[model samples]
Structure formats: C-alpha cells, structure tokens
Target: MSSRFLILFCGALVAFGISGCGAPHSPMTLALVTQPTRKNSLVKATSAKVSAAHQRIVRVEEVPNRVVTQSGLSVPRGFGVQLLAENLFVPRRMTFAPGATASQYDVFLSESKADRVSVLRVRKGRVVSKATFTREVSQPYGLAFWNNWLYVGNTDSVVRFPYRRGTVKAAGGAQRIAGLTKGGYNQHWTRNLLFDRSGKKLFVTVGSSCNSCEESSPQRAAISEMNPDGSARRVFASGFRNPVGLAWQPNTNNLWTVVNERDKLGDNVPPDYLTVVRQGAFYGWPYAYTDIERRIHADPNFGARRPDKVSETRVATVPVQAHSAALGVAFYPVQGGNFPKDYWGNAFLSFHGSWNRSEKTGYKVVRVHFQNGQPTRITDFVQGFLRRGRSWGRPVDVQIAPDGSMLFSDDSGGKIWRVFYIGK
Candidate 1:
C-alpha cells in the first residue's frame, strides 16, 4: 500500500481500539481492554483533586493599620488585636452570610439576652452598619447558616428562618424545628448548634441541668443530632458535664468539642478539655471522667453507682487548664491567611473565663496545635482579658473571618475583637 494509505489505516486502527470496535484477537484490541484501567486512574486523580480542594493550606501574611480596640489584651508580637464592634447585647455565637465582595460580609450575632439576631455589616475589617436582623428569638445562643436558611439555637428549641445572601433581615418569621430539654432554672442553658459538612445532620450541645447530678432528661449533658428540619432527634454522645464548644476538624472531618468538667472537684482535679467526639461515645459526667491518660476517674456523686473502673468511655484529646470554661471552638482554615504558617490546622478555643476557681483561668483564646488531624500541643494565643485581678472582657465564642482574621465575641464587655497577624 502507499505510505498515505498506511498512515490512514493506522489512524483508523487507533480510533477503533479506543472505541472498543476492534476484534478481540486483534493487537489493537489490547488498548481497548486496558482503557478501563486508565479510566479508573483518571477517576482517582479527579477524586484526589476534589479532596485537595477541600483541604486548606494556610500561609501567614501581613496587614497593617486596622482599628485597634482599647480593650486591655495581649496577643502575639506580630499580631494586632482590635475591637471589630462594641456594645453588642450579650453576643454568644456568630455566623457570616454571603456579601457583595470579598471584603464585605454580613456577620450575624446571636444576642442571648436581647432575644434577637443582630446583623453587622463588615466592610474591609470595619463595622459599617449595624441593625437588628430578627427579634423574639428566645435566648438565641448558636447561629448557623445553611441552604438559604439561618438556624438559631434557643434555650428550649432549635428554630430556623429564611435568609438570603446580602440581606440584612430574615425573610420570614422563625419556625420551631426541634425541641430541647429546657425549663426551670438550669445551671447550663446555652444550646450550641453546628451542622455537618454535608449539612445533612445538625448537632446541638445541651448542658447538664445541674452540677454533677443525674440529669432527669436524657438529652441533658449530651450532644444531640437530627435532620435539617428537626426530625429523628437522637443523642450523638453523652456523659459530658457540659460540652460547650463544638467544631469539626478539617481534613479528618471528625467532630471535636471542648467540655467544662464538674466543678468543686478541687482546683486541679478534672481539667477542661478538647476532644474528638465520637458517635454514641460517653465521656463520663455524673459517673466518671476520662483523664489525660484515658484513665477513668469515678465521680464522687455516683459513689457505688459508678464503678471505680469502667470501659467504653473515650478520653479527652487535650486537657486544658482546670476551670477555664472553654466555651467556643473553631479550627483554623486549611488555607492560612495572616496567621503564622505553624497555625494551619490548629484549633482556636475561647475560654469564657472561670468564675468558680480561687484564681481566675481561661480569660483568653488558646491555640491547640494539630499534627495529621490530631492535637499535639496547646498554647495561649490571646491573653490579658484579665488584668489587675479583674476581668473587663470575657470571650464567649470565636470565628474565622473570610479575610482570615480571628474574631471572638466577649459578652461581658459587649464587644467583638479581631486578631490578625501583622506580617513582619
């Protein structure tokens, strides 16, 4: 055959092989037979890209001359602390809504005492406008946004309202989605809410009714989960005296929280902790406490009702200082912003500040270092919320801004403080 004809014949054979049109015995058929292997490898490569897209790699940068708040506090040398907004009515938890630009985001603050969700228009790291987003929220503590709906955790129930991007007010009235164990004068009343990455499951943390007592309600002292519309409510985990802060670790997708252990156990008996919360796992509240070594320490309240030794309880991942009242937990973004390179994958915790201990502890934010999705060390990131044997600000919740600044709410001082690294 002529050279041109041979070239066309070879091209036809290659196309037939790719399309699986060649005979089984033909040499060109081998390429078709192996196509599935190559296709599967391509699928795996695509999956790896998807996973990497979800994984964040945070690198530190620098910005200067932001509004510096006069709050007496100390952050790292290369960082600056400023009050983003002040005079918030007992703000507890914060959530952000989509904005027009990268620098413009609407921050929704749950005013626990004001019975409303307040909206703050943040433009380039400054509060431009503030207004009441919604009212009559019934002691809203936790705020989360999903699927154009804003979920608010009230003292007695979980409610949701319709929301739109860049809109200041909720579109409609609040709808009760789930009922929580509430009534009477309870010691721990705050119900913090968090949604899974898929937004399929909603997790709510209910504190114990009393200190170290057998809770009459099963949901008390436990983390509960349910559908987005409040169906199939079940206890995810139990035995925590007060699991206040809830966060999901990046990359691992593991649910982690910080718990406030029973008080009056002496100054340093049972330290507060940050731990990976497993499904249906108990952490030993009225019966016992899992120490740093994963050893079970029986609670004095249970006496013989609690065996001195028990199994099946998971220990804390990292034990914090006693009576620190660790209340809010937020993981640093995988794509680090202005913070240090070492801060990537670390968890920032807000210790609301202890009131029961002889000496004050935890009036600050702490950085829990993580290696391969597991905590390795805990370090103080923000301090000086307490000064001169008195505290003027008590941080209640923490959040990471879209621009990569660390923002925390201080209810005691009615202020929200932003901490960002000022690159050297």
Candidate 2:
C-alpha cells in the first residue's frame, strides 16, 4: 500500500472510535458500521465515512435437477433456472416488448457482433420464435422502447426505428438521434441508453478513452443528458471510468449505476461498486477511489495532479468484490412483478467476472438488498460460471420480466437464462 493510502486508512480508524487504532491488521479485516441515508439521497452520491472492508455475501443455495447445475451452477432455494434462449450472437442488454402481458412477451435484445436488434417471442419460460427486428446498424448494444419508437444505442450513435408490439422487424430505415464519441482507451464501444423516471429526459453513458489518463473531451468519462429527441446534450456527471448499468431506486428516486473499475491495481485494491450517480458528481476516476475503510484515497499515480479534486471526490455506496466487473443492474419494481414480496425494491447486478485477480471471482448474478432506500447486503442469485478456474459464460446485463421472473444475458455463451420462484 502507498504511504498516503495507509495514512488515510489509519486516520479513519481513529476518526470512527474503533479500538486498536495502532495495532497491525489484515488489509481485508471487516467490521460493519452504520451508513445513514441522507435526507435527499437522490440528489447526490452521498459519502460513506467508511467504505469496503468485506462484502456481505449470504448463503447461495444450489438448485437441483437443472442443466446449468451440471456444471456446478446454482440459484437460491425455492427458485429454479431454465434456459430461455440459445444461439444468440453475443447478446447484451434487453427490453420486453410493449403491450404484452403475463408470460407472453417478446424480448428485444442487441447482438453486438451481429450489429442488429433481434426479438424473441417467449411463452411460459421458453423462446418460441426469434427474428431480426432491425439488421442495418453499427455495433448495437442498448435497446429501449418508448412512444412507438424502438431506440437503439449503437457504439457510435443513437438511432430509432418505427416499432410495434407484434411486428418482429421494422419497415424502414432508422432516424439518427445522436452521434457519440466512437472509441476510448479500451475501446469501451458499448453505449447504454436509459430514460429518467419522469420519462421526459434520456441519459447516455460514455466511458473514458483510456485506462487512467486525463480525458481530452468532456463527453468522455461522463454521462450525458438530453431531450429524448437528441437535443440539448450536456454532461450530467463526470469522472466515471466505465459506468455500464443504470437503474432508479423506487422509493428514493436515486439513480444507480454499476461501474467497472480500473485494472492492474494488483489483487483487490479498490473494489468495483454500485452507487448513486448524482448530477455533477466527480467519481475520482484518475485521481482517487474509495477503499475498504470507506475513505477515498488519491490514486498514487495521479493524485498529485489535482489534490483538491481527490479531496472532494464523492464516496461510493455499496462496494463489491474488486474487479468483479459489475455491468448491468435492475431493481424489482415496488408495485408489480411476479417476484416474491420480499424481493420487491431490491436491485440485481450481473458481475461480468474478473481477469486481474490471482484466483478469479464474480462470474454470476447477485441480489443487492436495500433498507430505507440504501443497499445493505449482497447475496449470490446464480453461479457456477467459473468451474475449476475456467469460465464458460460472462453475464452482461439483468432485467425483470413483466410476469415477475428475472432474465439475464450471457454474451460469452450466447445464451439467455431465466429464474423464477417454484415454492413459497
């Protein structure tokens, strides 16, 4: 650890009134501390006096008599997993066809490799039909439906096609809504589209161009907000390395995102996290990151450039396994859905797995439980992607079906899996 990081860690121990402020401790030592939600938690990513010590992962039940379980994969007790669709070419985010009810719905997904939108007709947990909704486009990654328009967020632009619930493919060309900065450091290339709760504005997440460097443009490393028709574009927040999944907390209306943090920090330096993405918040990309002790530390490499920026960097809320590559997030709706009542208002994340660790971690989905509009615990919902230290699939994003089941995409294996409750 750098001297500055150590000093910041020690200072937190003293500030929190914990005993043994001077004694040596394992870097991974964990102690739970209360994190009170702010009065207006939705307005900003509130600072946690302390951050990640250890992630709270509960018991993960192994399901029975399932194909995925053959490879040692598992889901929670009373829940069962079934294959929804197969043979997709690198599917990413998903959206249910509008005007559908119950388990009878068509899901639209983006095939990044195919560069087209495909719609799958699902009936009672199985995909009965698949067809190309639109084929002519760039690297399409995000899909959304609003006001009879199927909005597509390609790698380089936002476009829309005339869409109807039962129509598998559109009739004409797309209308370009917005053009985006094409590539970045790792060539992030994936552009995610999200509509705010009010349904009047749209938010687009654009990642920084490099691993950890000063960005050359404002649009890089920031989330852009604009009118739904692609007008009035402006930076909503900056300093995000790669914020992938965006969702809204129901009770508090707080915007949440799962960020894929920088790599090469050795095994577990700063854990990847899900936090409220407040407007104008600087999330310490090249300058700092909140550590296990809940204190934000300046990056030893770049903190010297802007000491003031490092000091004011907003603290992260819920911290997960470092390098877990948290990508897509979706919270169960509080009003309606097929999930059990206990699951309502909880958020689910797709951990796309990790490559920078000695022993690999995070190759499944997790349930992030919330209390008083704040995340409190994380528990595995699905697993076994990494068996014997080798992975077969990488979960990219998660979504809740209108009928109450959960759907997630695995790009590596080109498959979609659905989980549902089988018992009380």
Candidate 3:
C-alpha cells in the first residue's frame, strides 16, 4: 500500500487517530506451547519434546556488580550474570526482534534519558555490536514491533516508524499516531505499549498524574486501546497508579501487570501488585487497594470520593511487598526454551527500587511462579542491587532472549545484565 493510502486505511480502522503495524509482544507469539490442563498447580512435564536437563535444581548466589556497585549481585547458582553493554544513557524497556535464533538476536532498548533507542546485536550469548536505531524521541520508554513497523510509547504520544527484522537503524521518520497526556506527577512520564493477542488493538499504559487523586483526563491512570494507526481510542481498564509492565501468560493467555502502588500512609499498609488485567476492570489506586491476603480495602484518604467504586475495586492476583517499585515483567517460554521445563511459564519482574521509604525496598529482580497458568507466588530471583540499604544499580526492565537467557537493564548503572543457566 502507498504511504498515503496506508495511512488512511489505518486511520479508518482506528476510527480516530492514525497508526502503523506494531508489536503486541503478547503471549506465545514467540511460541511457548503448553501441556494438557491439569488440576495441579504446576504443569506436568509430559512432553517428550521438552529437554529434561532443565529440571536440575538451582539456588540464588550473592556476587558483586564487578564495576559500579562493588556490592554483590544475586543470581541463581547455575546462572551467570554477564554485563552485556554499559555506559548507556538510562536504558529502560527492551524487546527482541522477530526471527531471532537461539544463538543470534537483536534487542532494541530505549534510552529514555538520552532521547533515543539503540539496538544490541548478540551472537552466542555475547554482545557483538551496538548501534542507534532511532533518536530525537521524547522520553521513549515502551517499545513494540508489529509486521514491518516499530511502535514507541513516548510521553506525549504513541508513534511508529518502519522497521525490518535485523535492521539496526530506522529506515524513515516516525509518524505520530495517538496523543497522550505527558508528564504525570513525579516519574509517571514513562508510557509502555503492548498489542493484544491478535494485533487488532494496541494497549498503551498512561499513568496517573498524582500520588493519589482523581485524574482530570480519561487517559491518565488507565490503559487505553486503539487501532494500530491510533484511531478509536478507548479506555481498556482504569484505577491503576503505575502499571510499568504488561505480559501475557504463555499457557492461559491472560494479560498480567505488575503495578507500582501509591506511596505514604505508612510502610506496609498497601502493597504493590501483580494482577491479571480484565477489560473494564478497575483496580484500586487513588480510591482503594487489594491487600496481600487478597482482601480489598478503601484508600484511607480518597475512598470517600466514590465509595461504591472503592468497595467494588477488583482484587490483585498477587500483592507484592509495599514500596517495591515494580517496573517490568517478562514471562519465560513454556516450550522451545533453553531452560528446563520447570522454568517454563514463569515471569520475571524488575524492582526499580523505592525512594520515599526511610528504609529502602525493591532494588532487585524477582521471579513470579505460575502453576496451571495462574501465578502462585513471588520470590527473589536476582539480587545485589541493594546492599545494607544502599543501592548502586536500579533495575528498570527485563526480557527473555531467544537463547533462553534473562536480560535486564539497570538505568542507574547505565548497564544491561544477562543471566543464563549453565546447568547444575
């Protein structure tokens, strides 16, 4: 299609704004085939095609950051943490390109502070080259690829540019598709983007403007969807404070989000959360919250604004410890992954850490376990970012590489860490 016709076609589809093909990065598009449904919490390892070597046991180990922190980095015993690239200017979210192989892949990471996105070429688990994909962006944080175009969720808008698999640099200028509320209270300026399973809808996370107050715009404090070209915008879900990450479960295909809840009101009153997001569902943010035990309660200060909504707020599937600052979420592949079958369907999250708490919290990586397609619990996965209440590196985002290794970005250190299993 001609550029003009393609633009109009996309605009017609969205019914409001204009857009282009982009990545949803949704569940199993990379293909983690599931086993038969079972009542047990864990999926049965009955597939002969799955490698049994991944079943070997492993435990967390403490080590040093090697350069910056000088403090120990926590990782599993069998896995090694390799600093892929450093000196990046606030590297944030990341996405592996399509058509990647077990040994070679391309990761596009957004350096929000630098106002650019860069691509890292990895071969055999090591970074071979680094190059800029695009620049002159406004705090570009969220990234996705669909068909032949790449989408970026900037502070003020959702934009897209032509991108091809293995292409290190952008081929053309970006086309702004949808306008967004820019710069929320504090650090809510990061806009994360995701596409639904069928790529028919684009999900953009727009954070609330304040610590805990009624929002003035419909776009604030909500996840909204529109056509690929940015038309027919509508709120997908509401009442979330800061949902930094969005991932679809490989087995059950449910949309999961790790939220950063409101601060203040004491140390452990309300918890940050990992929850399954539903269409039209409202999660208590400025109004109320779902506790660690799965019980719902109204927000101490704002509950009276809408008592009905506060009382009716949906409960979180799993409540993380308060002030953890959950930022990114990545689900492990259930099939065709280098890790053992037991590691399949698990989700990894980045704790950007906390600032307001007197005693800081959440400066590490965590694993969210799933059984029978539902999240069972959250446990420490990678650590060492925090030592004696002082942190040198703050993890921002994480992604599973084509080789089944775990890669995370630490913005404070301006580095990326790759952890891969080496077997028992």
TM-scores, one per candidate? 0.81, 0.85, 0.83
Model 3 stretches astray by more than 4 angstroms? 1-71
- Once superposed on the true structure, which residue ranges of model 2 sit more than 4 Å away at CA? 1-72
How well is each residue in 1-424 modelled by candidate 1, as lDDT tens digits? 2211101123333532333234433221111111111111111111111232222211111112223235557665678888899877898899788554548888899988999899989999999999888995888898888898999999999999998787888899999999887753335888998999999999999988887777788899899999999999999999888887888887876888889987766665566777788787777777766433323455655634644322334555566666888899999877657688888888999999788777776788877777666554455678777877689889889988888898999999899999988774
Give the per-residue Cα lDDT of candidate 1 at 52. 28
Per-residue lDDT value at 156 in model 3: 93
lDDT of 1: 0.73
The alpha-carbon root-mean-square deviation between model 2 and the true structure, to one decimal in Å, is 6.9
| Winning model by TM-score | 2
Query: 2 or 3, which is superior by lDDT?
Result: 2
For model 2, where is the 10-residue window of minimal lDDT? 36-45
- Candidate 1, residue 252: Cα displacement in angstroms equals 1.6
Question: Which of the two, 2 or 3, has more TM-score?
Answer: 2
**Model 3: per-residue Cα lDDT over 57-160, one tens digit each:** 11212233222222367565566678888999999999988889988999899999899999999999888999999995799999999879899999999999
Write the candidate numbers in order of decreasing lDDT. 2, 3, 1
- Residue 290 Cα positional deviation in candidate 2, in Å, after optimal superposition: 1.3
Looking at model 1, residue 129 earns an lDDT score of 99
Order the candidates by TM-score, highest first: 2, 3, 1
- Candidate 1 residue pairs in clash (backbone atoms < 3 Å): 56-334, 57-334, 57-335, 58-334, 58-335, 58-336, 62-423
